[model samples]
Target chain A: MTYVSPPPEARSRGWYKRNEIAVTPFLFLIPAVLFFAIYVIIPIGQSFWISFHEWDGLGDKTWVGTANYERLLFDDRKFTTSFWNNIKWLVLYLLAIPGGLFIALFLNQTVTGIRLYKSLFFFPFVISQVVVGLVFSWFYLPREGLLNAILAVFGAGPVNILGDPSTATYGIIAAGLWPQTAYCMILYLTGLNAVDPEQVEAARLDGAKGWRMLWYVILPQLRPATFIAFVVTIIGALRSFDLISVMTNGGPFGSTRVLSFYMFEESLSEFGFRMGYGAAIAVVLFFIMLGFIVYFLWSMWRDEKGAR
Target chain B: MQSIFKASVAALALGAVAAPAFAESHTLSGDLRIISDMSNPAPRAVMEGLAADFGAMHPELNVELTIVDREAWKTQIRNALGANPPDVVNWYAANRMAPYVSAGLFEDITDMYENGDLTGLDSVKGALTIDGRQWGVPYTYYQWGVYYREDIFNELGLTEPTTFDEEIANCQVILDSGRKCYTIGTKFLWTAGGWFDYMNMRTNGFDFHMQLARGEVEWTDPRVRETFANWRKLIDMGAFIDDHQSYSWQEALNFMIDGEAAAYLMGNFAVAPLREAGLSDDQIDFYQFPMIADVPQGEDAPTDTFHIPSGAENKEAARAFLQFVTSPDVQTEINSGDGLGQLPVNANSGVDADEFLEQGFEMLTTNAEGGVAQFFDRDFPAEMASVGMEGLQEFMVFPDNLDDILERLEDARQRIYE
Candidate 1:
């Protein structure tokens, strides 16, 4: 009576119920895993497959082995230009982080209507990139734009910012940095808000102040925000397409083209769909991004292990 | 129930016997989809109105029109015509439609031409024909020429240029007067093709331009270099507005309208924007791009066309829509509408009362003594055109690099055409 054995099915069901702790988390992960595979993982594999073939978006696919990659590496000058521009974008876009930190520090105080001031400072991040691009294009307009007008006031003649090959990419990058800087500012602002007051007081007691106090005391606490800002800024810079598209359209003889815009122009432009070549470009970009992702994951893993 | 069944069978047999005789008058009913690049408000509204009118005439048919932005439509059209194809789609005549035709994405609509008056559509019909069969029905076409400021000319006491030398002299006069001779926007790349079309056609004439666009001639050929040489003369004369690469065609018009530039080489569609900017017919006028090398003037009059997709679910309904689109009444309505500002392809469709329209027609028919050439980008394969236009843009930006640009274009041509 105390321990009567149940039927085999009922006994197995009880065993399953007892092991729910081991299985429930995986069950919860199924939906996310499925979506990730469908949207991200599957497309990446398909892009790799497409890179081996010469296919217009509409017609039959013909396998051409590594011809697309060969063309990209050796034959295509536009590809080289785009790769260089992407590198430049990656390097220059990092300025947003310190720029944001400067602004966040300037507005970190709790004065009256400080909330309004913070929102105003964060306004650029809220506007659409397309609108930002248009604003920047108009800003750089050769004769009548704001930049030219401002120059004229100082007895300096107008300079074409977006029309010249030398300056066009920088002009677009400057546009991208406006919103990126605002984004970094908000992240830093939140990080600053979470800073421990007791630590600041302790540092003050030790006569630490200004650069010394901030570097020795505050920066260590802001690491998490800095990590996130760095990750996003890198991704943002790498995917800089909308601004270039709207502002210069990779013009001034295709000098402003980044990898993303070039890929689009190659495969989906009025130039006729070179799906194979576009896929090859995408594959190259994927590997470059994968390198960053692996480093990021490895670093994060190390940090987690250290924290434990 | 049995008696009723027998009666129905008898009725069916009788209906089948008479079906053939009544087939010509049968009303077609289905959803017709037309994907068009009429994103501008005026053309979009005009197309919408025409669709509504067509729908009204055939109550059984439903017309679903999708008007997409021009640049977006270029990409989307491939998908639209490649898979789940629309019943009808808008495209340019001649070489622009050639790829789709070769891909068998568009239907053979030669029968539609036989059913309509083909007189007025002779030029465009020739353009839309491939393998001696018509593939599309052109609805509208407009001439491209130098739209100049009449008031500026009168003020400077400068006469209209008739020869290449006179045009160059005119440019000098404008330059001396501290004004630019032309304003062109090369940002979209295709705008540069307009200048190339004018230069090539003026230098070597129509046949050569067509051959070059078709990739039959080497881009590095001496004759081609001469065309570039002539264009270099214009560039060296300071003919164009500064920083043209940053502006779109619409943006470049600002210079022309603001009196900073004296003229623009553009299609008739530009007239609406110019008019909107407060220029009247009296203030502005059209002139053929002047003669160069004494070759026949091969004018660029790009024709807008519509065609049924091969994968259309309802061919009959699509054909009806095409017929409606090309009908003189509908053509007249479209041309007269404020949006298109183009001439109708139907000969019976009377010309608009507007002076510019009248003059454009006269110049295209009587003055363009050589023949009509589709715009450079339209007349060439998209891949070749893209490379060609890029070379043209590079030349415009750095004329000293003409040889390098030409060589690069030649490389692309051999690769693409191979």
Candidate 2:
């Protein structure tokens, strides 16, 4: 190859190209940033803006200045019910993580048709949550449902699970947990595959066995999966709208309502679209979710620093 | 083809001499979009066929009809009407359309009626009128009545109850015979409103019911309390099925169909489901809700309406389509036979020979002088209706909480109306 030493412009172009690395990443990121801004970020800001106004969606917005928040916090009984229901959902929904870990551990061993067993275990998560909700709703039907039929055989229940105000939220949450548990199981299964076999062998040689071996060694290795499962399950619980919508529509006198469903109902024009009020509800929900997200980021950052 | 060619040549010659007249009769060409909630198989098929028939009649016009699921339609309608609205939209007749109309989301097509292009909708015109102006053209409505199992009634030596006492006694007898007197499902919430409407209208009379629906009367009014008290009687007698709140309206009908429950207070649309459940015509029967205190017997006949959105781009085409839909022929086709099984609003529309429809027509026409209510949910503002229906459901589950429920409903009513 001949060296073209006389080309000064080419040498300068090389300098510019060396600096282009930083700009190239940003250029590649622009499409995603634009989409995220348009679909997610801007709507969030708009919801915050709408929360301060009294607008019926189609009409001119009147600035009401914290009136919606005041009503939500003080006046609305439905809002209070929905807020408590959301808390109940969050608390109950956390059970999926451990339940999933147990299932993943049970199915992690190699055996005949192990792959088929794993796939079948993941089946509920594969279907849409809407479908899961519908199936669970049919299963919980007071008279003609599978659960009631089984209960009838034992002379126990013709219990109206989704009908009674006391049990409706728990019933929906249980339905939600089915798919959520499957999702966690899949996450843990992948995490288990990536576990270092050498570490397990070393721990076994040290006389560690069963629960202690798994808890101290295996679980520590699966931190990333556990973190992901926690984040997703928390978000899943907070944003549970479709299941409640499909199952009860926040019925049996609005006993099963969660915050998301309440926000939707408030802003639905069919229910007279109190847009400002709905936006207020959304802002409260956003703050709640933000608390979890911030906590997650803080913990992740701490873990990252500790690892380094 | 030859006749068409000859007619075109003659039309071309005549168009030159009478350009204005030709233009007047010429179908305006544009995309006329209609959004409907006729999502059920029978109604959806009828609506689609009607759109095709209308498109055939007007060759220049391109009709686009979007049928959406009923629940989805409720959330979608605001966006559908607020932004780039479809030319025509289907909605409930009265109070349900009021919010849209007040927000100027719907166009005033009163001219269509005055211009003689639309006629013979006197029965339902009142529902579409607000503040001395017509806002929509109603196409279909159905009667709400007590549908009972005739075989069960015959076996119990019972007849149709005409008075409140007789009805309570009949319910007592049905309970004694180990059957539910009424079956209702409140899982969707609106089903409870049907019971409330009949009780209110029967006790307080139609005018008071309308006033209450409009929020002119407080929910805690003595008359309103009486309505709840009467409803309490049914609950006390164990008239309704156990675990009524767990089922949808369709699922609740299973109790009636299986002979566990004797009667259901529902619309005429429920007949198809009953028949599909294998009930023969003779096995089913209808009766007006029993009189409570000798007040004029009002009937709930919720009418379905169509209106042109104010933001619609093709108003002329939309108006023409509305007129086409309300024509006697189209009305007859939509209302009669196995389509929607609803009553045609147009007086000139041909009647169906179905016994249930005949009974509904007779009952509705006779009670016409008293007034025809557009059920509780339809007659009240959406916000008020939501709150009111919630209260009704709460009452169903806890009849002893009537006082608190009414107070809460009054609070919601004041908040909404103000």
Candidate 3:
């Protein structure tokens, strides 16, 4: 390919032409960048802007700067309940990662119909969260549920898991964990397949086995899978709206509200749209997520730099 | 389907509105586009029939009807009303319409009431009014009351009580018989609000209840506390089903159906379901939520309405459509047992001959002496209602938390109304 740059007109736009190799990637990125800016970044800015005003979604915006936040931070009991429930969700949801790893290790071995076993273990993840919520809600039904039937078989009394405010959030988290654990198990299973067997054999030869081997040799090799799992699990815990919506609609007296569900309840729910207050809630959620995001990015950067 | 049919019919039969529907003598032209949320098969059919009938009447006019999913229409309503709205759309009455009314998204149809054709609309004028002006007109509503298992009452040798003392005595007897007196699901919170509505209205009268709904009264007001105390009487009696907070209102029906719960303090909608569940007409019956106080009885009846958006291009035709809907004949046809299965807003409209409808219609039109509330969630502002219902549910569960719950609701009422 001969470069035809003899045209004087082309020279005037020479910078781009000369740097086309470097600039072409950015030019190619234009569409994705524009989409992200419009759908993601702009909306985020809009949310922040809305957080400063009192808007009923349709009516004129009344600038009541910081009032929403002040009420949320100090006066709102429901907000306090939602924030604490989110904490419960985050802390409990991490159990899925460890739970997934255990199941992954147990299932990684050769067995009769191992493929069937693997898929069976992964089945929960395949179902939609809404389905999971519905199934769990039915299971928690005091009289007509399989859970109570099983409890009866054991001569134990029925427990209304979803009815009691004290236990409702935990019940939903447990339901959420069912599918999340499956998701993490799949991640770990793939990670295990990529494990260096020679390295594992060497570690075994040195008397490393069970928990010791899992902690030092096997885990170190599974860093990328673990990282991805951690990221998804954290985000899943934060944005745990569907299961809450389907399972409880943040009810049994709203004992199961997390930030995401509460935001929907305030902003776009049939109740009424307090878009500004919802945005303020969203803003708080964003900051919380931003903290974890910055940490994850920093860790990824550190890893990349070390590799370099 | 049978339950909705029966429930709505019973509700209509019980309605007391006696407004005379005047025929529209004027003719209208141009496109009358209507987007209705009557997406349920039965209501959808009724809405289509109304549109078709009206279109047939106005041969020179084009009637375009769009039936949207009831749930989906909720979020889309604002956007639809904001930009290029249809000529008329389906919406709920009361505070549900308040936001649209204040924003002027809805047409100020106060002048429509001045039209003699809509003279019958005066009775339900409150439901569709905001800021001392009418914004729309109600098409249908159903009565809320106790639908008890007459079989259970018969088995227990009991009768429907008419006063608070008798109510307690009957509940005690029902409880002693190893059955719950009431089967309520507070899972969604609104069911508890219904209980609160009856208790509060019965205890404090309808006007006081409305004042509380309007946030004119504080939650911690002694009168409000008295309402709670009255509700606590039933809660403490364990009258409601066990573990009710877990069940939806639909799911709670199992107890009533199975005879484990003696009654349901519900809208007339429960009648159809009771009949479907194999209860004979004699096995189930309607009653005013047995009067709890000396005050006049008030009832909760959430009215579904139709409105013309201000952005409508065919205001003249839309106005005609509104008039047509509120007219007595259309109201009777639409509210018939096979149509919407509910009461026509027009008091002059004759209801179906269904037993529950006869009782419900009689109750609402006559026995509902104090006032007709648009249910708790409807009458109260949305945010306040949401918070209030939650507090009410909490109170039902933990009666000792009354102080805390009242304080919290008082806070919400202050913030919400302000």
Best by TM-score: 3
Clash pairs, candidate 2, are: none
Please, what are the lDDT tens digits per residue for candidate 3 over residues A65-131? 8999999999888899999999999999999999999999999999899999999999999999999
> Which ranges in model 1 have alpha carbons more than 4 Å from their true place?
A1-19, B1-26, B114-120, B337-339
Name the candidate that leads on DockQ.
3
* Candidate 2 residue runs with Cα over 4 Å from true position: A1-22, B1-31
- By descending DockQ, how would the candidates be arranged? 3, 1, 2
Query: Candidate 3: what lDDT?
Result: 0.87
User: How close to the true structure is residue A282 of candidate 2, measured as C-alpha lDDT?
Assistant: 93
lDDT on C-alpha atoms for all candidate structures: 0.86, 0.87, 0.87
lDDT (tens digit, per residue) of candidate 3 on B41-150: 88999999888767767778899999999989988998899878999999999988888888889999888887565867677998888889989989998988888889
* DockQ of candidate 3 against the true complex: 0.73
Q: What TM-score would each prediction reach against the true structure? A: 0.92, 0.91, 0.94
Q: Which has the higher TM-score value, candidate number 1 or candidate number 3?
A: 3
How much is the lDDT of residue A88 in candidate 3?
97
Q: Candidate 3, after superposition: displacement of residue B257 in Å? A: 0.9
Query: What ranges in model 3 sit over 4 Å off?
Result: A1-15, B1-27
Per-prediction DockQ, in order? 0.68, 0.62, 0.73
User: For residues B151-250, what per-residue lDDT tens digits would candidate 2 score against the true structure?
Assistant: 9999999999999999999999999999999999887778899999889889988999898887899988998998888989999888999888777899
